[model samples]
Target: MIKHLRGVWISCLLILGVGPSAGWAGVDSDISSSRYPSIQAALDANPGKVVEVAPGIHEIHDTIRIVTAGGGLVGSGRIIQMDPARPIVRIDHASGATLRGLTLTRPEGRRETESEAVIATDTHDLALVDLRVIDNQTRGAAIELRNCVDGQIRNCLVQNYQRVAVDDRTATPDQGFAFRCIIGTGILIRECQGTLIQGNRVREDRLVATPEVKRQHGLGQIIKKNAVRGRIASQRDWDRGETDNWMQGTAIHVGSPETTDNTQVIGNLVERAGQGFDIHADHVILSQNIVNDALVGMKAMHGSKHVIVTGNQFIKNTLWSIGMMPGASSLPSRAAQGGQPARAANVDGGSIIANNIITDFGLGQTRWIWGEENVGCPIRFDHGQVPENPPLVDVIIQGNLVYDTGRDTLIKEGKPEVVPPRYRYAVLVESGPSAPVGLHFSNNLFHPGVRGISNIELKP
Candidate 1:
């Protein structure tokens, strides 16, 4: 029966003018610089075809685009972006476009830019498999998918993605948060639905935010003099030139609260990031991920809802291992007493955080920034930006484990000390008008740091 179906599919492809041999024409055909004048020429010659690149470094001066439906590029080749302003590859409005087993990077001078290594926008069934995006420092993401549905970014590697970037949010003065510099991101899924981000590794190669490194890079001088400043986001750190380090990049981020939905982030590894996973969407399943040596292990906020976080391991995180809060877009103006809508209508809650493990809290790369001052927590439920925003509700925190190794950990390069667990509480629930509500905690095993399990008693 399977053979019959395969024959039928082959017949259908033949009827559609796609010969079976044509599909495999470029596979291992040595489409190198000698055969093809440029990679774009090879792609333009073969529309709707899968062109396999040979095993060598290929320089791309212009943006390589895959716009035709069912068109793609694959094979074991390294593409270095010589163009600083453009993405290495852009898949615009393409369906079933696949970029597999390719290494995308940029030269050192071209690294600091807003362009992503591979960006797929308005695509469907886009598969980015076994791709390596390395040493491409940008304020934006290394791999970005926007308005793409049913896409998969699997078995990919994003390394050293964080560059010191300006976090300019000065336009929205109503929020009272303004400009500061920050790091970049690894993989960003914006307004994407039913996306599967599995078996990927996002990591930093070097410590970019250290005092010496920051001085050498002139990290503090990157902020422009005319940049609007209402109130700095991290005021204390901003004064100390430490805001950029603390606000480093997320390894994986799912944003676009009103549009993004039903994302599965499974079995990924994140190391040495600002936030391991910054989730700002709804209906997300974050499972079996390992986040090591990050500022925050994971945070679901910015109007996120119905998120299920389970079976993840967070290790050596300086900030909260797990955090959920309402954001600026949490409530519509009509839903609140005196709320003014900012971007879109959304809310926070209906989330489940269960069976997760957190070890070596307050021992990440940002430990020097935060210090051992009881600054971190295993779990936290916090408030929104404004009092008028609706509170987070209906969250279940169950079966989690917070264990401390009680050993000497690395503070920084050549600084290893037995720093005690710098946690305020195992679980912290903030108290305010917009504090999280309807939170249920049960069967969580924890080792207390400064305070016990929680500041407020939770009902099991």
Candidate 2:
């Protein structure tokens, strides 16, 4: 099946005239760069043809929607400026649509809400490869792939995003200077099967810019006089200069149990995202990814089954490294709200968490996260949230190194919050009257020390 899919992908690329790229002749005829002024014009003139963009900035006013089989809109050294109202590239119900080597960006503007940079819904054999999405300001996710089949987003770089912070700890608009903090996911794969998201990197903490980035979309303004709180604030000082606190979105968000059943997220680097990978899918394999600096490392909600989280280095996350809870559509804030309910009632089948190194949790965070009903905990098995069903049938937590900084374990002792409900624990199981079934906690190394004292047993 894998070989057949690869063969299909290669045949689609060849049919789109991707290979023999220099000479540029495929099954379909090629269009010259000068034939159409804008990228959309080229795509419109030749459907199912390979449209190559020149090495310059393409200011897109509207969404360039495409429906073509065995065709692509390719770019190299191309910076496509996105209109906030619309996605720069929209492929709808098309098969074999490829978008590669394009940089899509939307600078901070007067408009508060922005849509996705690229949206492909109901597409098959779609590949978004080696694309760099920089500094998008979106109310929605950056990349929205819905009901897509046999598609993959590989070797892509989605970085340096700071939208208007929804829940800023400090430096509000009333504070004189506006703050644009990091939010939103890199890609939202909703009900998409045969999808592989691999070798992608998503980050938000970027202050310095390369010459190429500055020349592309004026990213230099973020570090200068117009620097938002996220741009100028020090690592420890979230509100020092002009800080905004937003921890709501994920780097990669996978949704649905029926459509997202066979998806695999492998070898990705997710940092400083809202949630590294907010997963609600089943038969999902999340492996070999470095997940760090997020509110939560990886969240497996109520509906997820046959999920495997292994070989991942989860570091510096604030609340919980890996949280297994009932379905809430979104993360909670201090004001008392919860995510939407999960589609599936219970978490059945075998879920594996093995060989992961989770350390330095709740360190370098902007604010104290009220975890597991306002207590500081590293790993959460939340049975209290979803009272309707028995939470887990088989949960294997083995061969992992879990560590906690002093404050994360003992929140009341180490830097207690100004607010109420100060509590602490490292491993938390919120079952209330009903304890969890099929729980396994063994062969794990716990390190909690001040310098000489081994507080491993002391660690909760």
Candidate 3:
């Protein structure tokens, strides 16, 4: 039986003191210092220890809390060089800790709002290998997991988060801006579960920090400006009165449900980011990623269900690169509509959006699948509104490849809007009365030139 379950998982890690030679008490309790006077006294004299930080610069002012629960803290070939502006390391309430090959920085203005160079909370089985979180001014989410769970943020190299690097929020305030700023969103799983944010390199193009709006007389508006030109670092700003000012900043903002199922955002390389990867979790799995640019490169709103965004690579996002905003309209229309009749009426199910590769160079090369009714205009779903019962549902644009720049690829229905062109096999089936029942557009590949396949039948 697999070696008796690996000898009962190493005898429950030697009764929980996390055995592997319990807390190394050798080499004169090694605690090298170029400047970390006391990172919780070098992790409480190295509990479940293995400290050996050597590569220069180490200036932490406070907050390196590690409440080792089942003991296990190793830092092989270390290099704890911090002070990019503050927040060196703060892994509060720890568990099976493992932070390998470190190198975190942060100088200029000592970054603010609890500056982060590393911050985990109410921890769990954590593991962050091959680390290198650099250039910190305001956000370089090198590592920031709050209210943690079974974690594993592997092969890291989170870069210059002058704003947000790897932040994972828990105490939901509308579940927005969880990992804001930029460096890389290599790994950011919120409210956490069996997490694993593999192979990292999440980059962002600054211009974040716009929060402080409370208007409606209560007055608090701050919108310090940032449509995408610069300076944006505000966290949260509430105002549900609606004016189409629903901001949610991101680079990986997976909030909602303080604990769902097994989470996995496989093979990473998410670049830029004014907004990219904003999943709300629920049996997640965003495989083989390499999303570039950013304005919207994979946004799965609130009611997120059995998710599975396969073989990814949606480049040059300026808008609609893979969206699904099932907000408002009550909610439970099979949990925001998708496929399998929202999973046979159970409500929220469908989400297989398979075999990906959506590219768009710039200037109106839009429409890569927006929500609601799948509006057209560089993509705009929820914006089209619809979902009172079995009303909204029509998403299963199979086998991908929506490459445009040579123009022509508009698929719309209803409201005097009918614009179509790029057709290498068009199949717009919307057989009325509540539509949606296995809407598949089989084996796809639509380049700018076109081929042969047109079967339009709208009118819902």
Model 3 C-alpha lDDT per residue in residues 368-431, reported as the tens digit of each score: 2221222322222332123332422444556767665435443445334323332232223333
How far off is residue 459 in model 2, in Å?
17
**Model 2 accuracy (lDDT, Cα):** 0.65
lDDT of 2 by residue, 402-435 (tens): 7654444445557654332222455666655334
Q: For model 1, what is the alpha-carbon lDDT of residue 350?
A: 95
**Residue-wise lDDT of candidate 1 within 1-460, one digit each (tens)?**
9999999999998776687444432233334333678878887887777777877999989999999988888877899999888999999988988888889999877787788999999999999988999988888999999999999999999998887656654466532233344578999999899999999999997654466765655554424322433332455644443344436588999999889999999999998888999999999999999999887899998789899999999998876889998877677535434564444558899999999999888766677765455787888899877766789999998999988666545455688766556787888999987888899888989777777777998886
Model 3 regions lying over 4 Å from their true place: 1-36, 39-57, 60-63, 66-88, 94-117, 123-141, 146-187, 192-250, 253-275, 278-296, 299-315, 318-320, 324-460
Clashes of each: 0, 7, 30
State every prediction's TM-score relative to the real structure.
0.85, 0.71, 0.31
Worst 10 residues of 1 by lDDT: 24-33
Question: Of the pair 1 and 3, which is ahead by TM-score?
Answer: 1
Question: Which residue pairs in candidate 1 have backbone atoms (N, alpha carbon, C) closer than 3 angstroms, thus clashing?
Answer: none
Best-to-worst TM-score order: 1, 2, 3
Q: What is the C-alpha lDDT of each candidate?
A: 0.81, 0.65, 0.52
